[model samples]
Target: MKYTSLFTVLLVLMTACGWSQNDKQNTKMNKLTDFEEYVILNKGTERPNTGLYNNHFEGGTYVCRKCEAPLYNSEDKFESHCGWPSFDDEINGAVKRKTDADGRRTEILCANCDAHLGHVFIGERLTAKNTRHCVNSVSMKFVPSLNGKEQKVVLAGGDFKGLQFFLAQIPGIVRTKAGFVGTGSEKPTYESVQSGEGNYVMAVEILYAPEKIAFDDVIRIFMEVHDPTTPNQQGTDMGSQYRSVIYYNTEAQKETAQEVIQELEAKDVKVTTTLEELPSFVEAAENYQDYYFRSAEGPKNHSYTKRF
Candidate 1:
């Protein structure tokens, strides 16, 4: 006798949880049970604070139960405390939003199979993006990303404090690490870099999964969060250290960055962001690790507060 993996067993159990008795051969997706059908096939809402994924924090991809299309990543899930799983963002083109029956709330559905997931709300300000996709746990399944891709990109579009805040909130992104690059030195401290002792630029290392969130998505967010059109300036902060730059770690990333830049240029958006190969990333001082989250006066009073 052979034993199956825990993940395999979990998938079987989740599928069984939604397996229907009849009409299973007619549809492209797995037939949903009565409760799953209520929430996924028909527009229905689960009881608040009763969702399985609301408090579940694990590394995996949340896929639509109907068609199994990848919808949201675990990294995107946040503790909205709204009784359901809340995500600040979704995989590009994975979710579709429409006006609810009451014409007030925006209903969310799977783009691939049109399965009812839940609803999305804006202006919530629960996260940096100010958007939330409230979803029902029964409508989806969690597939662990056993070998998720991990890539690093260097971002510098003025105040890194703001960039760190936004990127940290984004789904598919790993721990937002603050550091320095492109200084032509082995390591540069915050004081040395700030005082022009090493000609280094203020930057942060964005670790992300390209599969879960497209590189273009990251670039788009980066462009929106800061004034890339400004040369070496972000609001009142003006210096070469604040220059908009993206240091790519791989040739593929470099190509993607160039392609995205050209697309923006075609639209007449003058992007002053530079594309450079990744350099030695020197970790910033302990004080600046997570300035936005650790701000004594709160993040609202910060210089980049207005951007978010």
Candidate 2:
């Protein structure tokens, strides 16, 4: 009888330990199954918590946790009280929408991947269009860098022909005879600047100029070669890095730009070119030093013409 009682006690202790281990595991899984980690791991779906996240006033960019793709910018985000982070518009082309399984609702997916994030609804008075994207917080991670002070600069280079072609691709740059001051030549000009080490000289500014190119012609070429329509901005290049301004050496150059504007208006084309009288032209950084000749293989299929 004593032996039987000892055996029973041992069996009961073993069962209790096993149950405890199982309970611990269940608790771990419950904690790890949050929405953000779930999207990062399983790429699963998350429902919008309309009450908790609907009126979120936080300012941050929402990024995909799985692939770290930037999904929404803070400026476009709004409070909809719809139970998720709401945005009137997505960053240019970050999020894509599709028909959901229920056939009555539209599903939202990450632009980088077709990961099902949540649903988008229309006819809500929360935003301009009454459209709200109810997203699950678990599918996203907040990134402060989106609204931080880190500005992006893009440096691009190509031949004179390539530059002309790139400008043509932009909607604003156009050819006009009214802005033409004199006969312009198509001969190329080369400018050389000393390197930082001063050991080797770098050739920059491979530009096309006419034999008797006037000051107005130079201004016209600068405007046509780059986007002057955007104030202190350029295509794919932002901030002051891509600004369009004339580097002038004399008062005559400034007068020529002003005259060209008058002539452009006379020809019925609105002129928005910026002219600045510069003391001297300084050599850009080595990386930004000579872009055109260095990147000859990049975007060279375009053609350049001297006439409007």
Candidate 3:
């Protein structure tokens, strides 16, 4: 009996020690770059529009850089145009909100590792969820979806800056890029196109998930957001490049555009929005991209061109 009791105690101790070692290894922190450490440990905020995930919208899981803890799902991310990665929701139990002395902002952190993310804002009305998790891209690493296949649509609705502002509010849109398209030149640039050298229309290319939103819905939203009736004129910017047009990539998209235009004309709205095959899409100069999203001072609810 003495020997049996001794053996049982030894077994328990061995198992307990083994479990502790395993736990320590499991919680090992990943090596972070200097920028990451600055944001995650020091609680520093990355510059607006500078974070990799700010304009990034891929099907993936965002995990903490420190401990690889799952923090957010890509589907919850939206284009707040606030120059940071905005997520309406986080993985349950993955994120915890904490209040600091300056209670004006709610700080979000990785619940598992307690790594500092960015601030959380409520009542933004930017998304139906009404919550925004403005996070620094360096604080989290993305694990892309295995079966994800992103799709896109391009539409020119006068100033892409104004168009992007409205479209970014939509729930399922993954990302929006301001660019020039429909130009015949080999290389189209913002300066050249804006100068009417290429006659390229300033357009916004939208990337979206098919499962979350339908293509027809994108077309409808495009029509509703901008004055499709005005030819080559969105707000005050008027030129051949500003003319409203849709660059379709497939027959289905073309047909969908036709249907939307027909529906608009049925309501006595003379539509001048033209349809053309997808052409060379050159993203505008870096400074011109995300014109409104790169800052928080612009029109929040509507396009800046609303007055004109």
Candidate 4:
């Protein structure tokens, strides 16, 4: 009851259909069973060691069962013998902690969906990190490790920060970063990219798990959130750097982009998004990565990201 108040439930319910809880990350919430609702929505606890992941150690990620947002990695998982899945860390900004209703212990919830995970205990020295994320297995869904199975895609749609801010929220995404691709400039700075340096569009490199989310789905979402119909422009930003594009890694990916374009055509939506091979990519400044998440006010184009 500390976190799952009636008003909170209604608020989450309204945003369940689409991302936009104050314009943050978005993941479609899944329908919960009675017991799942009891533990997650009602803040009930599962019996110790009875959860599946208590003694389970598999190389993969543990995502929130309700909304499927990445929570903890298997590498962070360890045996605390406390009758629950124990982790020393939660994926960056993926989990939020709050005081329990009893004013005794701290509770952890999915930052994306506010689903109850469990409690956190500190100073126990269970590990060198001196932290324990005692989470319920029923609150998580294990995604098998995709280390060797990693897939990547690069896209440019207006602001490098805005595009990444949206794509990073999708499920199974490992990383997203701003970068320069195909501009032919040996060194391209933000100023250079903004000048549309040598026609090299500013882009965001995305690494993801295909088994968890398909390649085509990513393309569709890219088109949904930005104006693919606009040429060399996104919102107020104008230049080649802001052009909409899909840097395809394979023929299949290229074809997928084409199919998405064709579908838009069917809807009378004239999409100008181009598909090109990914010859190379150069990482931009560190500050450009996860820019929106780092700031409360976000970027100048924050309103555009709220579209989808």
- The RMSD (Cα, Å) of candidate 3 is 16.8
Give the alpha carbon lDDT tens digit for every residue of 128-214 in model 3. Answer: 999999998767766656345557889898777767766765545666678888657367777777677765788888876677568
Q: Give me the overall lDDT of model 2.
A: 0.41
Candidate that would win on lDDT: 4
Lowest summed-lDDT stretch of 10 residues in model 2? 5-14
Pairs that collide in candidate 3 are 81-293, 232-243
TM-score per candidate, chains pooled: 0.52, 0.33, 0.57, 0.56
TM-score of 2: 0.33
For candidate 3, report its TM-score.
0.57
What residue runs in model 3 are displaced by over 4 Å at the alpha carbon?
A: 1-146, 184-186, 299-308
Pairs that collide, model 4: 49-83, 183-200
Residue 126 of model 3: what lDDT?
Answer: 91
Which pairs clash in model 1? 49-83
User: Which wins on lDDT, candidate 1 or candidate 2?
Assistant: 1
lDDT of each: 0.69, 0.41, 0.70, 0.73
lDDT of 1 by residue, 113-159 (tens): 78899999999899998999999876877675546467778887766
Clashes of each: 1, 7, 2, 2
Error at 13, model 3, angstroms: 52
Distance from true location, Cα of 19 in model 2, Å:
38
